[model samples]
Target: MKSILDTVARWLPGTPEIAMVLGSGLGAVVDEFTDLSVLPMSDIPGFPTISVSGHAGNILFGACSGKNVLAFQGRIHMYEGHSWTEASLPAHIAAECGARILLSTNAAGGINPLLDPGDLMLIRDLVVPFPLPRRWYVPDSPAPVARTGFTGFLIDQKLADDARDVAAESGLPLRQGTYAFVSGPTYETRAEIRFLRRSGADAVGMSTLPEILTARKCGLRTIAVSAITNVASTVPEILTHEDVKDQARLLLPRFSRLLREIISNL
Candidate 1:
C-alpha cells in the first residue's frame, strides 16, 4: 500500500499541505479549486471505490484559497461492505503524500436541539463503537482485528473560529457537536435516534470516524464538519436516504462557500 501511494505521489506534481475529504453532496466544493487535476479512484492502485450516491469517487489536486491541496471527492464507508482498514486507505495515502492537515465534511442528522437543517457543525470530538485493526486483535489469532477507540486530536480552535466567522459572513448557521458514526446502509430507527440522543450525540452519520482515526494515527491534524441534513431525534417521520440527498442538495452552495472560506483562511 505504501508503494502504491509512493507511485501516486510521483505522479503528482507537488506536495499538498492540506488534504480535504468531500462528504455526501459536499463534493461540489471541489469545483471552487483552481488548476484542478482529477484522478479517478479506479485509476489509483489500492484506492477503494465509493459505491454510494453523492460521492464523486475521485481525487482533485488544486489550489484552494491559496493553499496547495489534495481533495477527495468521495470516500468509502463501513456500510459499503468494506472493512474499516479498507475504508481508511485514502487518509493513509494522504498522509504518505505529505499533507499535514486533514479536513473532512459529511451530511448528518442533527440530534442537537440547537441545530437545524442546513446548519454546519464542527466536530470537536468523536465517539466510535468499533475497534480498528492493529495487525491482530489477540495473541495466536490468525486474522487481525481493526483498531478502534476515541481519536484524541481536537479541531484547531483558530480554524473552528475561522469556520464560524465564514458561516456568519456567508449567512450560514454554524454549530458545534459530537459526531456519531454508525455502520449503516440504512437510516436509524426512531428508537435508535432517541438512544443516540441519550448517549449525548449531537449529530449522526454513516461515515467519518474511521478516516479521522486513520488521519490522526498517520500524524495529521484533523478537523471535520457536518452539514445537518435532517432532524433525527425530533422528526415524526421515518427517514430515508433520499431525504438526506434532497436536503444535502439544498444546502450545497452555502456549505461549499463556507468550506472555501475556511480553506482560504487556513
Candidate 2:
C-alpha cells in the first residue's frame, strides 16, 4: 500500500483538498475539467482494473469550480470478486494524497415513493445488508478501524448542508435519505425491495458502503449523492444496466453542477 501511495504521490501535481469517487455512468463529469491529468488504474501499482460497463477507470487530477480536486472516474465493487479493502483502495489513496473531503456518487434504484428516474438523493445515512467483511491485513500498515455502530457518523452533516444549500441556489431539488447497500451482481427482487423499504431505505445500490466505511476509517469527512437511475421492483418493467447508464447520462448536468458547487463551498 505504501509503495502504491508513493507512486501516486509522484504523479500528483499538487495536493488536492477535495476528492470525488465517480460512480456508474457519472464518469462524464470528468470531461469538465480544465487543467487535468488522467491516470488510468492500470498504470497505478496495486490497483485493479475496472471491468463494469459505464465506469471509465481512471484518476483525474484537476480544478473544478476553482478548487483543486482528485476525481476517481470509476470504482470497484465486492460483487466483482474484490475484497472490501480492494474495493475501497481508491478512497484510501485519496486520503493518502491529502484530500480531507470525499464526495462519492452512485446510480441507485429509487425505493422511496417520491423519487423518480433522474432525481438525485443525498445520503444522510446507509443501511448495508451484507456483513462488512473485516478489513484485509496490509503489509506494514495498521489494521483498519471498525465502525462501532451501523450509522455512526458515516456522512458528515455540515457537508450535507453545504451541498443542499448549493443545490437550492442552483434550483436543483435534492432529496435526502438513507441508502441501503446490497452485495450484488443481481438487482433486487420485489420481495427484497419491500424488505429494504420496511427497513427504512429510500434508495438501494451495490456500491458506496465499502468505500464510505474506508473513507471514515481513513479520517476523511464524507458525503455521498445517489443519482436515481431506475425504480426498483415497484414497476413491472425489467431493469437493465443499459437503462441505468442512459438515465445517469441524462442527469449528468445536475450531478456535475452539484459536484462543482459542493467543491466550491468546501
Candidate 3:
C-alpha cells in the first residue's frame, strides 16, 4: 500500500495552499477551477468510500485564481459507517501534502429561527454534543486517526473574519453561528433539534466537525461554512436529501462568489 504522501504526490504537482471539502450540492464550487486534475477518492489507499447520494466522491487538484488548490468534492461522513481513521483522512492527507489552510463547507438545517434556506453561515464554533469525545488523527502517523481528544479551538478566527468580509463585499452575506455536529444518516428529530438549540447551536449537520478537528490538530488553520438548506422546526416536515441538495444548489452563485474571493485573499 502507498503512503498517504505518496498517493497525494502522485496526483498533485504542486503544494496546495488551500484544501477544501465540499458538501452535498455544494460540489459545484469546483466548476470554476481551471487546469483541473482529478483523483477519485477510491484510488486513495485508506480513505473512506463515499456512500451518500448527491456527493461527487472525488478529490480535485487544480488552480483557483493562480493558486494551487486541493479540493475534496464530497466528504466521508460518520453516518456512512466509516471509522474515525477513515473519516479523518481528507484533512490528514491535505495537511500532509503541505496545505496551509483547510476550508470545509456543509449543508445544514437551521436550528436558529433567524436562519433561512439558502443563507450562508460562518461557523464560529462546533458542538459534538455526544458523551464520547471526537478523535483527532496525526497526518504522518501510521494510525491516521490515532489521537483521542479534540481541541477547544476549531475555526480560525482571522480567516473567518476574512470570509465574512468577503461575503459582505461580494453581496453574499454570511450569518454567524455555532454548528451542531451529529452522527447521522437520519435528519434530527424535533426533540434533538430543540436540544441543539438549547445548547446554542444555530445550525446542524452530519459532517465537517471531524475534518475541522483533524485540520486544526495537523497545524493547519481551519475555516468552516454552512449553507442553510432547511429550517428545523418543532413541527416535523418531510425533508429529503434532494431538498437539501436543491437548496444548496440555489445558493451556488453566492457561495461560489465568497469562495472565490476567500481563495484569492488567502
Candidate 4:
C-alpha cells in the first residue's frame, strides 16, 4: 500500500483538499472539473477496477470551484467479488494524498415516504449489519498517538452543513437521513425494504459503508450524499438496474450543482 501511495503521489499536481467517490451513474460530476488529469484505476497498484456500467474506474485530479480536488470516478464493492482491502483502497489513497475531507456519493433507493426518485439525501448516519473490516492507522497530529482502530463512524458535521447550505441556495430539496447498507448483487425485496425502514433507514444502498469506515481509520473527515434512484417498493413499481441508471440522469443537474457549491464553500 505504501509503495502504491508513493507512486500515485508523484503524479499529483498538488495536495487535494477534498476527495470524492462517485457512485453508479453519477460519474458525470467529474466533467465539472478544470485542468483535469485522469488515471485509470488499473494503472494504480492496489486499486481495483470497476465492472459496473456507470462507474468509470479512474482517478481524476482537477480544480473545482477554485479548490483542488481528487475524485474516484468509480469504486469497487465487496459484493463485486472483492475483499475488504480492494473496496477500501480509495479512502486510504485519499488520505495519503493529503485530503482531509472525503465526500462520497451513491445512487440509492429511497425508503422515506417524502423522498422520491431524483431526490438528494445527505447522510446523517448509516446502519450496516454485516461485520465490517477493522483498519488501524497512526495520525499526523502534533502529539501523535499510537495506531487505533475505528468503529461506529458518522459523517463530518461541517461538511454536511456545507452541503445543506448549498442545497438551500440552489433551490434543491435536500433530505437528511440515515443510510442502510447491505451486501448486495441483488436488489432488496419488498420485505427487506420494509424492515430497513422500520429500523430507521431513510435510504438504502450496497456501497459506501466500507469506504466510510476506511476513511475514519485514516483520520479523514467524511460525508456521503445519496441520489434516490427509486422509491424501493414503496410504490407499485418494480426495480431494475436500468431504471436506477435512468433516474440518475434526472439527478445529475441538481447533484452537480450541490457538489459545486459545496466545493466553493469549502
- TM-score per prediction, in order, is 0.87, 0.92, 0.90, 0.89
Model 2, span 125-211: residue lDDT tens: 888654544433444333333343444678999999888998899898899999998878788989989988999999999888777
Best by lDDT: 2
- What would the per-residue lDDT of candidate 3 be over residues 157-211, giving only the tens digit for each residue? 9988988887788777789999988777778888888888999999999888778
Cα lDDT of model 1 by residue, 1-266, tens digit: 66668766877778898999888877888777888888888887766668888887888899988899999888888666666667677788789889988898899999888888888888877664433334323343212113344333546556667777776887767788888777776787888777888877999887887677777777787888998999987777877777888999999887887777777777
Worst-scoring 10-residue span by lDDT in model 4: 136-145
For model 4, which pairs clash? none
RMSD of 1: 3.5
Clashes of 2: 0
Tell me the deviation in Å of residue 153 in model 1: 3.5
lDDT of each: 0.78, 0.85, 0.82, 0.83
Candidate 1: stretches off by over 4 Å: 129-151, 165-171
lDDT of 4 at 208: 88
- Cα deviation at 188, candidate 2, in Å, is 0.1
Worst 10 residues of 2 by lDDT: 140-149
For all predictions, the C-alpha RMSD in Å is 3.5, 2.6, 3.2, 4.7
In candidate 4, what are the lDDT values of residues 1-266, reduced to their tens digit?
68778878988888899999999999999897999999887887766657888888888999999999999999887677776656777788899999988899999999989898989999998886433333211232111011233445468887888889877987878999999888787888888888888989999998987678778878999999999999986657667888899999887988998888878887
Better of 2 and 3 by TM-score: 2
